[model samples]
Target: MGWWKKKKSRAVVKEQTWDRDQWRGEKILEALIQCCDGKPNSIKFFTADQILKATQKHFCKFVFPNYIFMGNGTLDNHRMILLRKMKGRSPHPPRDICTGPPKDVAISSMVSDHKNFMKLVGCCFEFEYPVIVYYGGERQYSPVDLNKIVSWRRRMKIAEEVATALAYLHVAFPRPFVYRNMGLKNILLDKNGVAKLNDLSYCVSIPKGETHVKLTWAGKDYDYMDNDYIFNRVVSEKTDVFGFGVFMQKLLTGEENFEELCGWKNWREKNKFPKWLSSYMGEGRMGEIVDPKMVLEEEERCLMEAFLVLSERCIGLRGEVPKMVEVAKELRRSLKQGE
Candidate 1:
C-alpha cells in the first residue's frame, strides 16, 4: 500500500486502541496547544486551583450543574478554557441495546449509533471529568468589530458564520439538537465581533423514539423585564426560533419591550408585542425603531428592514416557528436583495 494509505491505516488503529481513561485530559491539552499553535507548555498539567487563581479577578462564579471547570489561562493575550469532562446526565439501560451474532460486533455497532452526545474540541473520555479547552477573550457588549457592524460585507460574513455554526448544531448527524438558552450572553463574540454560539448546557436532542417534542413558554419576561427569559414550557427547535426573533428585535430597536409584548394584559389589550417595530412599520418610523448607535444609510436601512421582517416572522411562530435553516435561508435571500 502507498504511504498515505499506510498512514490512514495506522490512524484508524490508533483511534481504535485509544484508551478512554486518558481521553479527556490529553485531548484538552492538545486542543489548548493547537489554539496557541506555538506556545510551549510552561506547565504540563493544569490544576483547578491554578486556573481559579489565574482568573480570580474575573471568573464569574456561576457554575452550571453537570459541567465542571478544568482550567483557564492566557496565551498570546487570548483567554483559554479547559472545561470538565462532558457526559450525559441520563443513563441508557443495557436492555436498550439489540443483540447481534458477535458480541464485539454488537458492542461496536451499538456505540457507533449511540444517541447521547458529548461535544468537546478534542478527545473523549479523558478521565471521568471531561476536559474541553478552547480560546476566547472576555465578553463585551460593544460591537467592536466595525467590520462586523458598520460594513455590509463584514456583517454578512458574521451572519453567515453564525448561521453556519447554528446549522451545525441544529443539523448534526443522526439527530438534530436544540439549544434551550439561545441568547446574547450565550453567543460569544470573537475579537472580530463574529458571534459563536456557546453555553450548550441547555441543549437537547430529539429522542430516538419520539416524533414531536412538547413546548411551553412562561409569559415573556419575569419580574417586568423585556429580557427573553422564558420558562414553564416544553421546548423544541421552534422555541429556538422564537428566541432568535427576540434577539433580532433587540438588535433592531436597542430597546427592551418584552414585558409589554409578552404581558397578557398589555399584549391582548393593545397588541403591545414588537412594541417599537409595530410603530415603525405602521408609520414609516424606521428611525424610531432602529438602533441609535447603528446609523444606517439608505441601503443599510433596507437590509435592516428586511431582517426586521424576518425577525417578525420568527417571533410570530409563538410555539410554531419555522426551522432555523429555513429562517436562515430566508434571511440570506432578503440580505441578497437588500445588497
Candidate 2:
C-alpha cells in the first residue's frame, strides 16, 4: 500500500514513449503513468502488447518467450516482480500439468501461506496463463542473474537458504511437495540477499508414504532434471535432488550447458562424471573446476573444495546424495566456518 499512497497529481496523466532498449528508471516511471491509466489505486497486471503499447502503441512482450524486459520499474525504483507464465515447454497436455509438477494454481494456493515461493498475483482464465509476480521488485533477480560472478561465501549462503526452502516444500505441507523445476535460473535473490525458489508451475505434492508420482511429460530444462524421473515417468523428492545437483554444478562451473561444455554430449548413454571435474578433483587443482571467471581467497579455497565435493554428492556423484536437510546443515556449517 505504501507504493500506492502518494500525491495524486505527482502521477501525471499523459501518453509517453517507452523505449525498452533505452529505458531508464525515470523513463519507466513516466511511461508507467500512460500504461496504467488508473495510476496509484489501479496498478495491476498488463498484457505484453499493453505493456508495449504504453510506449510504442504496438510492440508486444510475448515476442520474446522466457524473457524479462523490466516491469520492476516502480516509482520507488524498488524492484517489483518479474512477470511470467507457464515456464514449461510445449508438446504437453493440460492434465499433464497436474501430474508433471505444480503449476500456477499450486503456487497461488500458497501465496498467503508460503514465504519461500514467489506470489501468484493475477490470473487469466481463458488462456490459463497465470501471472507470476515476485514482490521483491528491483531487489529480486534470478539466482544466476545472468551469470554474475559471486563469492564462495555468498554462494554458500544461497545453498543453505535454497536447501532450507526445498526441505520446506518436501515436508511442510500435509503432503510432500516436489518442485519439478529446481534449476538455478528459477531460484531468485531477494532484497535481503536471501535465496527464493520461484517457478512452482512444475511443483506438485505426492501422497505421503508414496514413493513417487507418475508423469507423462518432462519439465523444462532437460539438462537440469533427473534422467531417472524423465525416463521412468515417476518422480519423488529425490527427483528434485537430482535436478538440484545439476543446478549446483551449473552454479559452480558457470557453464550454460554442462554436458556440452564438458564434451559429454552423449553423457546420457555413458552417465560418466564430467572429465574436467573428475580430473581436477583428484589432482587438487580446485582452480580448474571452479569458475575461471571467479577468484577465491586462500581460506575460501578450502571451503570451495569442500563445497564442490558436497555438490557432487547431491548429484549422486558417489552413489547416494544425502537428503536436503542434511545438505542444508552442511552448507550452514560451511557458512559458519567462513564467518
Candidate 3:
C-alpha cells in the first residue's frame, strides 16, 4: 500500500508539470496572434530560462517599484528592463484576463520608431502571463525624487518630448490610440536624461470614423483622470490632454497629489481653477505655485507662467482644450524662447 501511494504522488506531480507547460504554450500563442502586425519579426521571444538568468534568478536589481527589475542579459550582453505581471489578478473582463501584457507589447512595438517612447526588446512566456522586456535606463522619474529633476528648463524639455510622443500616437496610425494613463509614474529617464513614456496597459484605440470610445477607467487612481472621462466613460485625445494637465501641475508644484490644492475638492462643482491657484495667480505670485525645489532664473519665470497657462487650457472645458499637436507646438516655442 505504501509503494502504491508513492507512485500516485509522482503521477500527480508529473501531471501538474504538464498542465503548466500547456498553459504557457497557449498564452504564448495568444500573444503572438494579437501582436503580430504584418511584421511579426519585430517582437523577439526569449525563453523563461533566459529571462531568469538575465534577472539573476532572484531579481536582485530593482528598477521601478514592485513589478520591474533591471538585469544584464546573458545571451546579448545588453542591459534590460524586465516587467513581471503579477498572477491571480484580473483588472479587466474575463475575456481580457491575460491581455494587458500582450497589448502593451503590441503598442510598444508599433511606436518603436519614436525617441521618447520606451523600446520593447522582447518578451518571455514561461509564466501564467508574459514577462515583457525593454531597454533599461539609469532610473525612473518619480515625485519622491523631485530633487533629481531640479531645473524648470529640464522639466519643460521632458514635457515637450512627452507631448510630441502623444501627438504621434494620435495621428501616426490608421486608428488613433488614446493613452488613458499619463503621469510621473509612467515617465522614465534614460542615461542621457531624455524622458521615455512607457506603460501602455491602459492605451485604447478609437474606432474608424469615431471621435471617442467609451471605456471603463482602468487606472488605480482618479486624481489624474478628466471629468468627462470619469463621469461619462468617454475616452479620446482630449482625455489624454486632461491627464497631461494634471501631470504638468505635478511637475510644476512637485506635489504628488494635486487634488490636495485648496478648493480642489470643490472645483468640480464650481468648474473653475482651484482657490490656491486662483488666489496665487490673482496676486501675481507665480513663485508660490512653482515647485520650490526648482531654481528658476528671472527669464524662466515667464516661461513657467506660459506653461501654467497652457496646462490650464488642457484641463479646461470640452470646447476650450487645445489638441495635442497644438500643445506640442506651444511647448516647443516656449522652450526656444527660454533658450
Sort by TM-score, best first: 3, 2, 1
Candidate 2 regions with alpha-carbon error over 4 angstroms: 1-82, 87-102, 111-115, 126-129, 134-143, 268-276
Off by over 4 Å in 1: 1-46, 49-132, 136-160, 209-211, 214-232, 256-276, 317-320, 336-339
Q: Residue by residue across 62-113, what tens digits does model 1's lDDT show? A: 3433333323544324455434333332212112111111111111121222
Give TM-scores for every candidate, taking all chains together and pairing residue i with residue i: 0.53, 0.69, 0.81
lDDT of 2 by residue, 188-210 (tens): 66667777776655666686679
User: lDDT for each of the candidates?
Assistant: 0.45, 0.56, 0.68
Clashing pairs in 1: 23-126, 24-126, 84-130, 85-129, 85-130, 215-234, 216-233, 216-234
Native-referenced Cα lDDT, model 1? 0.45
Across residues 193-266, which tens digit of lDDT does each residue of candidate 3 receive?
77778877667778789998876544545657776787888788998988888778778887643556545656
The runs of at least 3 residues in candidate 3 whose Cα sits more than 4 Å from the true structure, single-residue gaps closed, are: 1-41, 67-71, 77-98, 137-144, 216-218, 262-276, 317-319
Clash tally, candidates in order? 8, 13, 0
Residue 90 lDDT, candidate 2, scale 0-100: 31
Would you give me the overall lDDT of model 2? Answer: 0.56
The candidates, ranked best first by lDDT, are: 3, 2, 1
